[model samples]
Target: MLDFFSSNPIIALAVILAVGLAIGQIRFLGISLGAAAVLFVALGLATANPAIQIPPFVYQLGLAMFVYVIGLSAGPVFFKEFASRGWKLTLFIIALLISLVALAWVIIKALGLDSMIGAGMFAGSLSSTPGMAAIVQIVNGQDPSMVGEPVIGYSLAYPGAVLGTILVAAIGAQILKVDHLKDASEEGLITAPLVWKGVQLSPEITGKVGDLPRLSGQSIIATRIVDDPHSHRLADPQLPITPGMQLLINGTEEAVDKAIAALGEERETKIEDTELIYTRLTVSNPEVAGRTVGDLKTVEHGFMIARIRQGDTEVVPDRNTVINLSDRIRVVVAPGRVAEVRKFLGDSEKSLADVNLLPFAIGLSLGLLLGAIPIPLPGGTTMSLGFGGGPIVVGLILGALKRTGPITWQLPFHANRTISTLGLALFLAGVGTSAGAGFRGALTDPSSLIYMGTGFGITLISALVCAVFCMAVLKLKWDESMGVAAGVTTNPAIISYLNGQTGTDLPNRGYATVYPTAMVGKIIAAQLLFLLL
Candidate 1:
């Protein structure tokens, strides 16, 4: 059994992932990905496997796959957010990254630790394995053996970071108590009660349109027609009758009867007012599929398109764009005309469960391949091509160019979740196996462990301080506050947990906003600290 465990690293990884999944599903002590790595190390140590090894190339492959998946998920919404919200969130994320680097730098200088070790300390403190790997690649080239210590150092502090983030998130939610449903009820934000009001036609307006005294000069009470407090008036008394016009003689029913006697016209049956109508429709027809806003106008009643919500992202339709099946459309139109629009567009009901997973897998695989191609950076440095910050950049470019896949292929929630989980598991497994072997060697010198500990201490202090600032000063919600800490860690799992607590589908956005800056800062800090020390 021991020999089997020793011989099969892939099987070992699969067991770890399965354990993680089970723990996640059962809510057993909130075991994080970082904690899983720590557990793997403990297991390896207990077994006394001195020759424990994981191929360096596996690390590269895992990193590429991980980054590629992340990039594909973040690409579409990141730019859309930038265009809408402007620079506030972007600036905040950038500031946090700078703060983390500066804090790491100061701690390194004070401790007199090796610069590379400092970098490792920074990465571990953030719980960011990819950042550490990136720095190692930059400083020590693609040789994994040369940069092994820093990666090990990073692995040491990751578990604590994950736990710390979870604790913070739960506490924040308890404190904030953000209940949108309660607030909406208290504020009377909806008009369902007003929708039940009945309409009556004035007796002055008979069945015959011409017999009705010219309403052209009168200020007609059209409140139910448009929901506007102000009423509209006919410009000409000679104007002919429309299908659904209401005429009134006086404010009361008796006055209306006297007016009908004077006008010699009979009252027609009352129709439901247009302003009380609300239409809900789903897109089922193939005509709108893969078309953008520009293409939608050609369909009759398509002009009634008010808003288009695709997954978590919602946007106003434009003329050049195409619509996809299952996209929800909200429009304001006359009560009688709504059926016409509905009939023209077809059924719009879409089940969230029907989202296609194929495109996501294809995009993710392609992204991974693209990320694995190593590219040279400035100076004498060349980083491995696999995912991390570079793949996200490449994916964004590809997404914009429509080179990677179809532009209309919107990412589904389940596919994103699956890819992210698998990628992270592989990534953490690589980090754990690599670190488990090297940790023993690195700890041989007590001074090295002391230096690493000090660096981790600095990271913890910096992260906590920033977290406090985000909460106390910036007044960010618990999820957002935890997101800041997770940003420092550069681990998607931490972000995912926080988003889960918030019950939102925007874990990808939180990751994307903080990832690039964290990656760069961590890499620079790790390398500069190693070089300087």
Candidate 2:
């Protein structure tokens, strides 16, 4: 049986995922591991039979995909948060990491353990793969025989590190009595409902549609215009508006009313007659994915975009709004142009379900290339972001850009979630199996137990301290603080777990804000632990 399974590693992996998902669904004391259960299941199975080894490529690929999607999703608000509180969060995480490294140094020295073990302990407890890699390089150069030392130390502490972080976050949120759903809504994470009004241009009104005075910060879209009783077309801000011309405006109630007052009085009339109509359809077109609303020449095509819906969030799109695949957009179209608009938007269900791999592949390759580039350090040494940091850094930047030239850097909401979840599962399962043999070997030795326990203790304390400092001193919300902790720890699993608990991207925002800096800092700390001590 072992020989057969070892020959068919793919089959073994499939079964593990199947069983893990089933086991994850079983709640114990109202707590379930969810997708993270895949890790433990793989660990146990591999411990029994060391021959059931998975390839290293599996986890590395998974890690890159998971983080890249997270970066893309979080990028929209990451920079904004950093601009406001980036320094404080950056400094706070740096201080926490430095303190952890110092404490680890003290305990390691007292135990008379090797420097590599201590370095690995810090990385393992924080679940920092990049940190582990940095220190591993240091060990390899100094003493090639000690290369295995860091892996052993990392493996012994890894299980506790993943599970312990989850517990700390759960307990901390529970103690705070946080209302995550309410918190998300209050922070404008959810979009407001839209309203539309029919208006007739007032005689006093003049100039192009763009020059109209609107309520400050209002998001109003001028959808359609009436040049005559029988002649109606989509409105363009560049087009000159004359008195007695009617317009259909879509926006929030206040914004619509304000636009109506600015343009003309409201009229009891149908903006969409039999010929001119409005249709809300999904954006299933790959060709249009990267283009902004203005770039589409909506008015030239006899259509105007009103609003857009993606996942649970709704948005009022302006000229600058970039259209993503799978978006449900409401547009007003002129007479006899419905087919043209439908064709342009590719209103096909199949297209909506399919993932566009072209941009995804390009973005990921760019990230890998960026990761492999050597970065020089102060002591004539060098480091890189590695797989852990590379994808995420690129993801965030591309996500914020939304597109570059013709390539759309963003994935659809459903696709992003699916890819991230699967990638994370693959990464965790691979890690568990790869470490299982070493972990089991270490378990029998009493000294190894001490090292593992020390790792777990340091992980828990660091998380607790970070949680307190963020919420009490920094005054960040529950999700935000957890996001920061996960970021500083450089563990995708931690942020993934928090995202499931909160059901909001607010945590991702916090994670992205500190992720790049924290990851680099932790790597430096790990190297210093090896080189300095």
Backbone clash count for every predicted candidate, in the order shown: 23, 0
lDDT of 1 by residue, 1-533 (tens): 54565587666666656665555454445434533443354335423553444555666566655565556545545665566542455566566656666767776777676666567767777766667766666644645465656766665565556666566666656776855334333433221211111123344444433233234222111212221223322212223444435442222233344444444353342324423243556665544555555445432442344345665555434344445556666554555576776765555445434555565456556655664566565666544533455555555544433322234344334544565566666665555555555666665667766655665565566556656776686555444556666766676557767655654533334455555555545544455444444
lDDT of 2 by residue, 1-533 (tens): 66676688898788778888788777664456566678678777777786777676787788788778877877766666677898788788888878988898888888888677777877888877657755655565677545546756876676678778889889878887889988877775644468877788787777776555342235687776766656666678798878787876777787777777666698655654545777888888777886888788877777788888877567778777778878898888865788889988988888767777888898888877787788887788676766666787888888888888767788877889899878877776766666566656766877888878899998888778878898799887888888887887767667778888898877877787888777667766777676666
lDDT of 2 at 170: 93
Error of 1 at 397 (Å): 3.9
| Model 2 error, position 359 (Å) | 3.8
**What TM-score would candidate 1 get against the native?**
0.62
Candidate 1, residue 45: how far the Cα is off, in Å:
7.2
**TM-score for all models, in order of appearance:** 0.62, 0.80
Candidate 1 lDDT for residue 299: 29
